[model samples]
Target: MELIVDATPTATVIRVMATRIDAPTALQFKEDMRAITAGFDGRIILDLANVEFIDSSGLGAVVASMKQLRPDQSLELAALQPIVEKVFRLTRMDTIFAIHASADHACAAGNT
Candidate 1:
């Protein structure tokens, strides 16, 4: 997983440029997030622009990261490909994680 971090006024944006987010690399992705935002407070906006696929384990890892964020921190997802959006909607996870049209939109929504 190749993740690039950007600071937004409302959240930390992470653009993931990976073909697939399956079992093999989910853990590393999660660990990378943990390491990158160690002392930060606010929200996480996962920009999934380049991710074409995600399995159950990948979804689980995302949820786990949200859980790790703590009592007040927020985790949101953005720019999901149609296939990935379907996965979240099919699993009823769309209602759980806030979805946005873009990373900037995600950060803006989280700010409010």
Candidate 2:
């Protein structure tokens, strides 16, 4: 699993390059998110376009990452693969966090 973080003026985008965000890669994903948001106050957009699968731990890690962000900051998610989207909906988290169809949409949310 590879986690690449990119920051925009309005949001920090974290892209996960992995087939699955399961137990094995969840911890690293959480840590990478922490490191990326350490000194930033902008909104967060986690891009999951490359993630094909996600397990319970993986879902938990994503939630944990959101919680880890500074209280002043906000967290959003974008570009979720179909299977992963199903998980979020099934877990009823689709309503908990802002979900966007694309990164552009996510970023635009902060703009307006």
Candidate 3:
């Protein structure tokens, strides 16, 4: 799980650089997210534009990432591919997150 971290005034964007987030990479993803987000004080926009697929374990990792955040911090999702979006929707996880069309959009929305 390769993720590019881009910090802006409004939010920290973590762009996932892989096509798939499945069983094999789920643990690494969680660990990386923990390291990247530790002590972060603002919103985190997870850019999923490059992720074409995701499995249940991958989804669990994402949720776990959010759970590990500090009380003042947040985790949001953006630029989800169709398949990945479907997975979130089918699982109703979409209701648990603030989903954006893109990272830019998420940043533009600010704290909303």
Candidate 4:
């Protein structure tokens, strides 16, 4: 479970280096997210470009991650592949999280 954490001016970008966020990696995902997000501030962008598939557990882990953040802090998602984007849309999670087309777009300085 490799996560590349990039601290940008507008948001902290956590890029998941792994390919799948499924039953096998869900627990590790939550644990690692908790570790990295500790005391973090501002908006957080989860880069999911490499994640091709996500199961129910994976979705649950994502929700848990968002919940763990401070209420004032925001958790956005970026670079979702087709399958994963479909999953979020199908589950009506797209309405819950800010979904971006790409990481670069998410990090754009003027974005709010």
Root-mean-square deviation (CA) per prediction: 1.4, 1.1, 1.1, 1.2
Arrange candidates, best lDDT first.
Answer: 3, 4, 2, 1
- Candidate 2 Cα outliers beyond 4 Å, as residue runs: none
What's the TM-score of each model vs. the native? 0.91, 0.93, 0.97, 0.95
lDDT, candidate 1, equals 0.86
Q: How well does model 4 score by local distance difference test?
A: 0.93
Residue lDDT tens for model 4, 52-79: 9999999999999999998778899999
Which structure is stronger by TM-score: 1 or 2? Answer: 2
Clashing pairs in 4: none
Clashes of each: 0, 0, 0, 0
Give me the candidate number with maximum TM-score: 3
Candidate 2: residue pairs that collide: none
Error of 1 at 90 (Å): 0.6
